[model samples]
Target: MKYQEFFSITIEHSYFSGGPADLIVYPEEKTRKLLEKQGFLLKRTGTGIKVLLPMRDNNRVFPVLTADDLFAFHVLPTSGTVREFTDISEIEEDNMILFTNEGLDIGTIELIKSETVKEEVFQNFPALAKIEIKGNQITTDVIGTPPVYKAIFDSKSIKWKYYLLSKSGATDIAVETRGDQLQFNELEIGNNSLDPIITSLRLNFPDTKIAVFESSVAIPLSSKSIKDIKLIQRDSVTQTDSILMKHLPNPSIYDQGIQIIKIK
Candidate 1:
């Protein structure tokens, strides 16, 4: 299998609400070959290739590479009758992928920014490999027998940030500015639950607006000021199953999956 067979990139039509292309594009032969090796059927009409629907029955057409996506795939189109192909010259420099292995396979895919690889083949890589899939991005390092936790707080200026005495699991926190208020967009608790992280964050930034993502009813927190907490239902069909297939081995440390919370 070629290096590119280990992965494919996709974005939903919602990603581009402006317009759709009119060209009968075929993802340059190399890209088509790679995707086909991975079980993707490149639908061909009598005279032209057709676009496949984006996953999850989305309205957007996916797999059509822009200049940047082509650079990430490290392919240049030779000659094509297609009117909407991504020209190699238009590719952004930063969009190029740097693979650890010469023949980029699943175990050697270098995670850069927000990119995904074949989930089923991901476990062959080291446990410490940083992986970003769906809304979750995790990287782990071994410490003692169990892994220690590293807290990632998302804020411009947290009152007083403190390093963790011990690490637990990889945690993700995202905050976005909402007018004058700092809205905690999302929080994925570590393996140890919300107590430790919440305590530490509260200690650092006492009274700040925050929100937690939760599936069930809100659990009362000691901080009465954290009343902005919002309860959200978990996706009935989550990408977790795809990313964390039982066949794929997890790191030694326990993972708390993800959770949400809010404070104001």
Candidate 2:
């Protein structure tokens, strides 16, 4: 069986400073089909929900940042006077907004509202022959500028397991057993001593051949059944209080009790 990835999104749409629509609008049929093609399946009746399934083990996913490019239907009626410019020079002479459908400014709506040219505005523009604009004339030779496209991947979510153990009472330790090894992933001691916890764990799991303790505790157990005690400590030397757990197949032999070797 595979686990489901659950997520939710809330969208507030506005255009031209109009108040947002009162009702929550569902995605159009075409948009839903596009998302389905990209492995995002939406609910049959719900809004702003996607049901993700684990199709592969290492599959990664991210969240969409902006929906500014998504299409929406709009209705407006207007009439404008038509004028023609004979050449690029004529258009530049007017000092009007230089608009383009193909080169450099594709997919963006830029309004050249002022003569005060901003350097960053043209940072990605086709290189200019000259930087200075003389008397409403762009004194730059035109080059074959390519269209600009940008994609950003900024957010991702991972599945994790967390346990919040209270420190005021018994230390909470979580472990997994495979074969003869008892592997602990996390151990939190609030106010209790490590000795009682290890003693209880040994009694509870008497058949465990090897005790793998992943935490700050280096306290050796009294039970001889635990022949090999592997302590996961951050440094080679044990701290006054702390535990770490890294795995190893063959444990070292030490007559003094618990053996700790820092991972190289």
Candidate 3:
């Protein structure tokens, strides 16, 4: 029933490559008791110990102990002989160290970065979020009944809007649609200028029908071909009244943006 039992950790010999770990060990009852006494709740899941430590600003979560931390403990056998240990306490301030049950230093856990968390969120919940990168702007949409969109357009400009699309950039050709309104800036284009953009949109949404409208001009598209085009307008609405609704689709568009959107 402990948190560690709910989760598991595996140490690999190589990261980003396929290699088995030299040693793989799990927390014993004694180790769990020690961590529990220190206010760490352990949950046992199929993956490994889900160790929930008290939230501290500097604390981080790592799935495995690192080689550097292992060096300090000096791997010793179950026998009486002791192994030579390295003095890593001097660099301890720069690293986070974790110990193994056998009294050996396993490794230092690396700090979890924001990018890593974003990737994890996308990978694990691919249907619930949308990740988009255009030029220097990074936009994410966590769409549902009450959709939430987070955008990091620039390091200095970070904003979140609820049910509204905001515009930026010169000429404001970059259009974002939210709620019941579509907004754009400096909209001046002819057939040639809109063709590539419409083609890109068709390429992005191959499964859905695309209709581009500019004033009284409406172009219904069924194929992926770009010819003469000017201004382009793109919008998506989920069809809720289709006879094939069950087989219609899942939220897969966000995967193109490296995000996942989960709707409850």
Candidate ordering by lDDT (highest first): 2, 1, 3
Going through the candidates in order, what is the number of backbone clashes in each? 14, 8, 35
Please say which candidate is ahead in lDDT: 2 or 3.
2
User: What would the TM-score be for candidate 1 when compared with the true structure?
Assistant: 0.16
- Model 1 scores worst on lDDT over the 10 consecutive residues at 244-253
Q: What is candidate 2's lDDT per residue for 1-264, written digit by digit as tens?
A: 243443322221221123222222244444456455545554422222233433346643333323322311111111110011011122243232222112223233221222222222122332111111111211112442211211101111111122222223223223333353544455333434365545554466444322234523332222123333333223335334233333332221222223322221
In terms of lDDT, the best-performing candidate is 2
| TM-score of candidate 3 on Cα atoms, chains taken together | 0.19
Local accuracy of candidate 3 as per-residue lDDT tens digits, 160-229 = 1111111221111122333313232333434355556545544564443333222222111111222221
Model 3 has an lDDT value of 0.25
Residue 4, candidate 2: alpha-carbon lDDT: 41
Q: Give the alpha carbon lDDT tens digit for every residue of 170-259 in model 1.
A: 233222222413233344445455567666665665544333432222111111122222222233455221111111111110123232
lDDT of each model, Cα atoms only? 0.26, 0.28, 0.25
Error of 2 at 101 (Å): 22
Global local distance difference test of model 1: 0.26
Alpha-carbon shift of residue 259 in model 3 (angstroms): 18
lDDT of 1 at 223: 11
